[model samples]
Target: MNKSHKYKPLSFRTLFLILGLLFIFLLIADLLLGSVIVPLKQIYFSIFPSAETNETFRTIIVDFRFPKAFTAILTGMALSVSGLQMQTVFRNPLAGPYVLGISAGASLGVALFVLGFSSVISFGVVSITGAWSLATVAWIGSFLVMILVLYVSTHVNDVTTILILGMLFTSAVSAIVSILQYFSSESMLKAFVIWTMGSLGSVTNAQLTVMATAVFLGILLAFFKIKDLNAFLLGENYARSLGVKIVSSRVLIFASTSLLAGTVTAFCGPIGFIGIAVPHICRVIFRTSDHIILMPAVIITGSIVMLFSDIISQLPGMQTTLPINSVTAIIGIPVIVWMIVKNKKFDSV
Candidate 1:
């Protein structure tokens, strides 16, 4: 299948078309298929105004579901791309945003904001009102950790060393979070716990704009590295022989990965499995390791999975949403295990 994979019955163009149509369908379903049972007619008309929509349905579509679903899609795209970049950069199939401790750095930052700064200031004057401060802190921490990883990657020759370092970093940050939790008040502790569970609906329209911008920029940066990334699949020595500037490419990848991992973590908390699982899913489904195809496929599939997760989170007539990470784990884990066992022959490649 891979021999003539490039000239298949459905090309990248067709795959993209299918994904685009699915994206549109999911967007409509996400906005209309929630607990309220709002008519699809109302949703379609709300966007087209002249078609006919009631004020209440319009409010639900415009004010609530639109932002939530948009956030979910953007978050899925961001995490998937970052996972792709991490796999390429480290040359490891299992490398990912959370596995690399990048998300832990984010968690630490959130811990600091929610536990450290807010505790000092008057609660009403600070970010006790919203998720902004926590998100900002997490982004900062992720940036700092990515910088450190980039530095170490340049110095360390073995990829395994860097992976271990990342694991150590995650453990260290987790310990710090534990310490913070021990000292925190009961309310703050509860807030931190909730944030760790992950939720996509917290993003408001303004936050969605920011999140969308971050994901777009990161994706653009990721696409630009395709040549270097392709070269990288051959390992560093061969890439160097091919005149790839290893250092600059690594720096750019670090920046892009950090932006993706950090922003998503900031906005959605630490979403696991999607990062490690989706790229491999792409490889299995498409039967190709080529990044150009894999990247787009992963993005589409990731967005679909997340949209479905969002739908499950808001189960029919449920009073409140389930944690997004929980839903993703439930869906992603078994598939990942199956993929791993089925594709263990990849070790020979």
Candidate 2:
């Protein structure tokens, strides 16, 4: 008898089922565990809108928590998938939206728009002008940065070099934003400062629509490039040997990354860690690099992490909420440390 005869393949259906249940549980918990702690029965009635439903609970659930929850879902899925794509493209575990300067570029764009027009624009006034303007400028900014990164990739052979260039680019962009902030009006500076703090609660219903649309398109692009992503993981030359069009594939993946990451930054501010940490968690859970399995795994795990973070940020029975950025950093930093400790010689994902 051979050892091969005794091997049995594993099924992920069970794992996926458990994750799905966890996703639903966390989502509900996010809604129910906010400041007021709306009852599950009221949540049901709020959705169905019975006459007996408490108006206060209905207002909190339908108007505030619902949009915030949906924003978390979008943020998680967008950042996680973009992170996976970046890791695959760069063959580095550290590649992500912020690390690559994509979010910085988006932030720069927002800064110019807000700070440049500081005389008129204020924290509260951005909503009155509409969210599309903010999102559009962010898209343009991120696109420009992606184009620059692509140019560098074509000329440089080393992924480490590209990553270094990206960090430099981000630092440069931050300097420019700081200069703009210095000249900005008090109201405008306050607005930009608040944005940097990262609050999922800041997203309005209308802004959520724009975010959802952008994220959906980005995810669609990722789905189309699944084959290309799977190929790239084995190395560019190997991917080319398999007839994958390297240029076009890189363009599409970079574009998808910008859209997903930029839109999130535009709506929710510069969220960190979800993009870097979620993909690695997925790879561990699924124990495979195949994008087919990893894609869905990243989406669900990302959502769970974000929703859980949001709940903690609320501090339950407290009126004061912690910054979403701080919460994510606390959750994400430990994962990065664990990766280093476990791999010791880690260089790439």
Give the least accurate 10-residue stretch of model 2, judged by summed lDDT.
1-10
**Tens-place lDDT digits, model 1, residues 1-349:** 7855664656667767887898888878888877787888897788888746688889888988888888888878888888888888778877888888888888888778878865632341234344455456667898788888778877897778888988999989889989988998887788778778998876655556667877888889999998888888888899999999989888888778878888788777899888887887777666666888888888898898889889888985667788999998898888877876886844521
Residue pairs whose backbone atoms clash in candidate 1: none
| Positional deviation of residue 275's Cα in model 1 after best superposition, in angstroms | 1.0
Q: What is the alpha-carbon lDDT for the whole of candidate 1?
A: 0.79
lDDT of 1 at 199: 84
List the candidates' TM-scores in order.
0.89, 0.94
**CA RMSD (A), model 2:** 2.5
Off by over 4 Å in 2: 1-10, 119-129, 343-345
**Per-residue lDDT of model 2, residues 202-256, tens digit only:** 8877788889999999999999999999999889999999999999899999999
The candidate that achieves the highest TM-score relative to the unseen native structure? 2
**Over all chains combined, what TM-score does candidate 2 have?**
0.94
